[model samples]
Target: MLWNKKEKNKPKNISLKLYSFNEEIIFNGLLTNFPIKEELILEKTIEHFEDYDPCFFHRSVVSRWMYFEIEEYLNKIDEENKSEIKWQELPENIKKILLSDKVINRVIVEKI
Candidate 1:
């Protein structure tokens, strides 16, 4: 059987495990690619979490507050210009909340 263009372009799924601050499994699913490095894994996990549900961080008080703060900040920005906001341009406190250990612990990526 020959592979078609759609098959060739299809994204591969990699096993991923996202842990909470206490090492609890927050997310377990397949990702497009496995991120090898520890930091990369964490970033990927956070990205997945955001894609799955941006409000998942609301479970914690500090995280909840930070999440709303980010929402408020984004709301104030012009709708047409909101898309131009980059992660680095966000406030340090908001960034810290997103990257905080209290919100997420670690991520493990397994190639399938």
Candidate 2:
């Protein structure tokens, strides 16, 4: 696939907000409790990211454009492994999010 000159020059602005209340508290209190401000915020952001898994917005859009065959792709991965596969065997976060009605309808059913 090749992009035309206009497509190549398109601007992009993507934001991923994955922070918890506890992380916000820790970040806000850094100036009063810790000497290191920027360093502490960086460390806290890393820690917060560990808790929340991030799926890129661009990837989601691209996947939808392909007819939302994500399940087929996942099944292929499981089949290639040649092991028993179940929803419980998948990542906890994936299992939880995939089972949700909103995600299912919007990203899966609607696209397919």
Candidate 3:
């Protein structure tokens, strides 16, 4: 797809980490808050939170936080067996984002 200057600036990936605090918090920061969800996603082209909170970096946003290859990470979310995350359980920020469906024209298993 050909993205122009304006469109390219939009956040292509929404970063999140699992088990941030202590243990067993899969899809960690994915369900966390970021001040105000509407303000952030709207104002900024790309939102990043690698160190703001602690968690396993499941989605590789950039080279600096590259735990897994981008292709592999994207593919992982496509699989059918991806964990199911309840909508009510999601934090306000994440819930709004996912529900808005700003992701893109792709097949990403956005359960958890």
Candidate 3 is scored at a TM of 0.23
The CA lDDT at 44 in model 2 is 39
Score every model by TM-score: 0.32, 0.21, 0.23
Candidate number with the higher TM-score (1 or 3): 1
**Number of the top-ranking candidate, with lDDT as the measure:** 1
lDDT of 1: 0.43
**What lDDT tens digits, residue by residue, belong to model 3 across residues 2-91?**
112454433333344433223443343322221223343333324464343323332223322221222234334445354433444444
Ranking by lDDT: 1, 3, 2
Off by over 4 Å in 1: 1-8, 32-102
Query: Lowest-scoring 10 consecutive residues by lDDT in candidate 1?
Result: 32-41
Displacement of the residue 38 alpha carbon in candidate 2, Å: 35
Better of 1 and 3 by lDDT: 1
What total of clashing residue pairs does each candidate reach? 0, 0, 0
All candidates' lDDT scores? Answer: 0.43, 0.30, 0.34
lDDT of 2 at 73: 38
lDDT of 2 by residue, 11-54 (tens): 21211122232332212221112122333334334454542333
Tens digit of lDDT per residue, candidate 1, span 2-112? 112354444334354656656776556654221223453344346555433224342233333343444445444433343234445557754554353335555454435
